[model samples]
Target: MKNLNPMEVELKLALAPAGPAALTQHPHLASYPARKQSLTNTYFDTPQGDLAKARIALRLRQVDGQVLQTVKTAGQGGGGLSQRQEWEWQVPDHELDLVALADLLPFQGQLSSVLHALAPQLSTDFTRRSWQLTDGLVNPGAIGQRSHIELVLDEGEIISGGYRTPIREAELELKDGDPEALWALALTLSEQVPLRPSDSSKASRGNALSNQHWPLPEAHSPAEWLHRATLALDAYHDSQQASFLSDAQQALATLADHPALDADARVYAQALPGGLDAHGQPSTAYGNAALALAHRLAYQTELR
Candidate 1:
C-alpha cells in the first residue's frame, strides 16, 4: 500500500462528550475487539507558511515508539466526506527527510529550501480507539460487497498558546468496502450519539492555532459558516429521515440566532423566498448564507 499515493476517503463526525461511551456499546462494534492507541502529531511549515500557501501539510506522528512522516495534498472535502492525496513514510527517528518528500511534491528542486525554512507549528494530541467492522450476517447491506470498515473514536484536544479546544470526534474509513457503506454506518451511529459533520481536518485546525486565531465558524464569517452548516444539515437529513423536520429547523435556527449570521440572514432573506423550507423554517437564513456567503471559512479552516 505504501507504494501508491492513496486517496484518503473518509467521513468525520463531531460528537458530544458521551459519544465515545455510547459508540463503544454499539452492537456492531461490540461484535469485535477494538485496537487503541495514542497519537501525537507535530505539523511543520515554513515561517510564512509556504506549504500551506499551496494547501499542503507535512507532519511527523509518533505512535507508541514508531515515527512516520506524512505529507497531505489538499482536495475537495465537505458534507462529512473527504478525499485527499497523502504520502507517508516510515522513518527511524522523528525527522523530515526532504529528499524523500521531493520525490512526491512538485517543488521542482527547492524541496530542501522549503524544509530549511520549516519549523514545528502546532500539535494535535488524542487517544484513538478503533474497531474493525464488517457488514455482518444481519445487516441489510451485502456482507460480500461491504467487506470492512475502520471505526475510530478520537478524544482529546488541539493545543496552542497553552489553550486547548476539546475534540470528541469519530471517523469511518472504508478499508475494504464500498464507500457508500460508510454512510450506512454513520446513520446507524448517529441514532446513538449526537453528531455534526466535520468539514475541517485536524491538521487544518492545528494550523489555525499557530496564527493566534480561533476558527469558530460563526464568529469569523457567517456566510462561510452558513455554507458549511448547510452541508452538515443536508447530510444529517440524509442520515435520518425520522428527525429531518425538527433537526433541520433547529439547524436553521442555530444559524439565524447567531449574531454573526443574523444580519446576513436578513440581507439574503428576500432574494431566496423560493428556497425556504415548506415547514416555514427560515429558508432565507440558510439560502442567503449558502448561496452567497464568501468562502472565508474554508480559508480559515485550512490555516493559511
Candidate 2:
C-alpha cells in the first residue's frame, strides 16, 4: 500500500475517540449487541523496509460477564510469521450488573468520530471495503471458528504467490456464564490441540527475519508470556530438531502457576508428548494464532 494521502491521514485522525465506549455507542455497533464486550485496540505500522506491512495490536476487553481479557497479535507478511499475547481477568458473574454494564457502553458518536478520523488515513476506501467479518460456526460455550479470506491483488489481478500465512482463524471462547467454568473450558481446549508456529519461523513458509520490524514491548503478564513462549515452542518443534524439547517443556512447566493463564496451560504442559511430525506439514497459512494455541494445548498428549 502506498503512503496514505493527506485526506486519508486526516480522516483517521478525526476518527480517534480514545476509548471503547465511543465505539459501543456508535449506531453501527447496535448490530454487534452480542459483542456486548468492549476493547481498545492500538495498531502500529511496520518499518519502511519491512517485508510485510506488519501490524501490532493490543486489545483490552470487558466481556459480558464482567470478565476481562487482553490480547495482542502481530503479523508480518513476507515470513508468514505472527506473534500473540493474551491475558484474562477473573471477574465473578455475581459481581457483574448487566443493566449497569449496558449503561456504561458507548454510543454511536464515538464510532462515527473514530471512523471519521480513520477515513482520511486509509489508502483503501473504508466505505467500499468489508472491514470486519462476524459470520462463523458458533461452538457456544465451547469453541468458535471463524475464517477470513481475502484476495491479494497485483496489477489488477489476484497474486498467485504462496501465502506467507493462511488467513483462517478458529477461536475457542471458553464461556459459561461462570468465571470458573470459563477457565475450565479454556484449559480443556488448550490440551486437545497443538499451537501452530508463526509463518515467518517456518522454513517452508517465510522468514520472520525478513525486512519487516515492529517495536514490541516486553510481555509482562503471565498469559502473555505463556502465549509467546508457546509460539516459540511451536517454532522449535516444527524445526524437527530434537535439541529444544526439554528446554521447551521446562519453560512450559514454569507457567503452571501463572495467574493470568487459565488452568489449561498447566494441563497441556503435563500432558504434552514427544515426537516428530510423522505427517508432512501443511502450508504456512494453514493455522492462525488462536488455532495454534488450541492445537498446542490439545496435542500435548502426544508430547509424553
Candidate 3:
C-alpha cells in the first residue's frame, strides 16, 4: 500500500463476557462521558479474495447517517501491539469507488482491474461507546501521563452468509500523547476489569464468518513464544491476561528457567530500563519451557 497516511496504532484487548460492564464501572472510564454510535460496516474483496491475499481489508461503514470508506493494510506487529496503514474517505452514496481506493493502495500492475473485481464479502454491525481520558489524575509523572487515551467498548456481531460471531472487546487508542500513556491506561483498566490480551480485529472475524472457516493460529516455538512475550511486554508492559504470556513463560522455564532467560528477567525486575515501567515482570517468561514440554502439558490433565 502506498503511503497515504501515517500509521494507525491501536491496542485491542479481548474482554471476558462481563468485560464491557467492568470497563463501564471502572472509576477512570466512569469519570469520563461516553459517546455512543451504531455502526454497520461491510468488507469487500474480489471473487478470488485477492485483497485478502494482499493482506488488505476494505470497509464501508455507515455511522449516524454518514458513509465512510476505510482501507487497512497488513498488521505490522503482534495483536497486542498493532500498527498498520489506514485511509478513510467519505462516501456520498452507495457506490464504493475502487479506482479511487486503488490509488491509495495500488495492487498488481492493473490497479483498476483489481479494484473493479472487489465485491462485498462480509459485514459487521455493532454499537460502540467510548471514553477519552486527558486528566493526569491517574498518573501525574509517568511517561505520556498527560496524553489522551480513547477507550472504546464495542458490543455487536459479525454476520456473513447466515453465520454470526459475537463481538465484545475493548479498544485503547492513543489520541495525542506519549505511547506510554496507552499502556498505563491499559494496566489501570486491566487491574479492575477482566481484560484478555487480544489481537483479533473485527475485519478478520468478519472474513472468517464469510468463508465459513476460522483461521487456526499455529503454536509458537519456545523462541517464538519468547518473542511474542517480548512484543506484548514491549507494547503493553506485561499488563495482564496476555494469552501468549503463559506459553512464553513456560518456554523460558524449560531451559532451567534458562539461566540466561532468568538473568534477563532479573535484569527486567531490578531495573527500570528506559522505555519500560515497573509492570514488566516477565513472569510469563517461564512458560512451558520447551516445545516438547508444552505438547506434553497439553495432553496431561496434571503436570505431575
> TM-score for every candidate vs. truth?
0.70, 0.29, 0.72
What's model 2's TM-score?
A: 0.29
Pairs of residues at least 3 apart in sequence or in different chains that clash in candidate 1: none
Candidate with better TM-score, 1 vs 2: 1
Q: Count the clashes in each prediction.
A: 0, 51, 13
| Candidate 1 Cα misplacement greater than 4 A, ranges | 1-3, 106-113, 137-139, 214-227, 230-304
Which candidate, 2 or 3, would have the higher TM-score against the true structure?
3
> What is the C-alpha lDDT profile of model 2 across 51-138, one tens digit per residue?
1222222122233334332222333211112223232334343232223222221212232222212211101111111123222211
lDDT of 3 by residue, 99-186 (tens): 6675674454554577767789888889999887785733445653467777789999888767676777788777676655665566
Candidate 1 lDDT tens digits, 204-276 = 6666544644223332344444444544343332233335444434444554555653354445423333344
Residue 196 lDDT in model 3?
45
Error of 2 at 152 (Å): 16
lDDT of each: 0.62, 0.28, 0.59
After superposing candidate 3, which stretches have Cα over 4 Å from the reference? 1-4, 108-112, 135-140, 143-145, 215-223, 226-304
Best by lDDT: 1
